[model samples]
Target: MIEYQTSSFSQDEIRQAAQIQIQELPQGFLSSLGEKPLALIFEHVATSQFGVMVIAKESSNNRVIGYVFGATDTGQLYKDFLIRRTFQAIRYFLPKLLSWDRITKAIETLFYPARKQQKRQDQEECKAELLDLAVVQDYHGKGIAQHLFGEFVEQLREKGVGCFDIPTTAGLDRAHRFYEKMGAIKVGSVIVHEDRPTYIYRYIIQTRKHG
Candidate 1:
């Protein structure tokens, strides 16, 4: 049996989630930062008020198997991570700066959203986002991803968010399909990491009517 919940996760659970992140999302930039740094980022997100993380665990062993984490305000989340975890972030990311490609990607990540905002001022409503969602390989096709998504949406609604965005790379068909299946609308596309094309999707939460 598997249990899914959004709460203050322990350090061990955060570590497990970080490992799964690295194993499952190998192509992501953060995954390349290594496990310890990723784990620290997860911890920061889990503890921050503007962020939310839903973790799935095996009920039998209380082992974390999957997780979906994001921030209510992605811009603010990054800012806080840089400010509050300055030293740690520098320690982990400084080594990667030796590569010019890494430096470019870092600059793009920091400024891409702002650039997108300038181009699409009409999409000002898309302040929140679903950052990362992943399930253990063995747990795929068991509906764990869907369940985690639902929980994340609920948490966002409770926090008074009306809409959220999801950005995925062009070739990730499965991810695109899943987002579409969950009723997200593809709004547009943008280039990130210099030449990598990414699609942006938006999901609007339907508010429940009070009788």
Candidate 2:
């Protein structure tokens, strides 16, 4: 049996689970968020308003087997995160910025801030996004991901969210199929980095009509 609950796991435990389950970081906006810092970021997101962080544990031994992180308003959460964790972000990013490639990329991004405007604009109607979801390999085919996602959607809807924006890499057929199975529609695609393209999907919640 498995139990689901709001994230009460420590940063290290969450990071370790992520390390095992999430093999690749989506390249583009999330390319810079490395493994070590990702855990810290999750910590922040878990506590933000409209934030959803849930963990699943194996009842037999009380071990975390899967987790999901989502937000009703990713844009606002990030803004607040920056404001609240200014020094922390600096502490984490300063060393990475030391590399010549990192410095060059930062400079280029600063000058080309308008490139991602379309993607940003699309978020105007998207009320939520599944920022991250992962389940341990050993637990595959056990319906854990399905349960976690179902709960996530339910929680977001309770918060008045009607639409969700989900992005996955172009080559991820299995993932694309999974979201489609869950009622997501292919909305659009955008190039995140220089050449990497990501497909954006939308899932709209149908509201009951009152006579």
Candidate 3:
């Protein structure tokens, strides 16, 4: 009953669906939301998947079950955010990478976790990222997440983008295992959240024609 659709950005449905599991999502996840009049990072999604963001719906109930948001063209956004938050980054990243294990264990104690984060120089090769993904608790175990992910990945593949990201919380071992089993690589964690038990993970999507 899940129906995938393009993100409107104006409809509260996407944000509402996300609120169902917002606390479970990562930080820096929605920093783009409040930045401008439009507020979200990706507004174009082909209006489908490649436009940057999308939402999944349940036809029978007419409810938005979940959503995944991302855009590859935001190098400037990340670069600017990092510069503006330089002090916080310096103060936090050191201990984060230093005590990754401990942080991973107590991530629920951490604030809204990040499903993605600042990237390294080498990772600039990666294009899109899974900023935040959430399915309503009542809709869990019904393959909703997979459906949403499939739509997003397929769209990115069509665009010729290869690599993407999926940030995870160590406390949510089940989630980490899910993405890994789905083919994502554990490149490492964000230095700021290493000690906090949260990590920024990555995945590669082959071209649509090839995949």
The best candidate by lDDT is: 1
lDDT of 1 at 165: 90
lDDT of 3 by residue, 49-94 (tens): 3336667776786676777766563444455434554565456443
Please list the C-alpha lDDT of all candidates, in the order they appear.
0.88, 0.71, 0.57
Cα displacement (angstroms), candidate 2, residue 86, comes to 1.3
Tens-place lDDT per residue, model 2, 27-100, is 43334646655666777877778578888887798677888887787666766777888898788777768777
Q: Supply the TM-score for candidate 3.
A: 0.63
Residue 94 in model 2: lDDT: 76
Report the lDDT tens digits of candidate 1 across residue range 58-99.
Answer: 999988889999889888888888889899888877886778
In terms of TM-score, which candidate is stronger, 1 or 3? 1
Please give the distance, in angstroms, between residue 65's alpha carbon in candidate 1 and its true position after superposition: 1.3
The 10-residue segment of model 1 with minimum total lDDT is: 116-125
> What global local distance difference test value does model 2 have?
0.71
Which parts of model 2 have CA positions greater than 4 angstroms off?
Answer: 7-9, 21-35, 100-124, 208-211
Between prediction 1 and prediction 2, which has the larger TM-score?
1
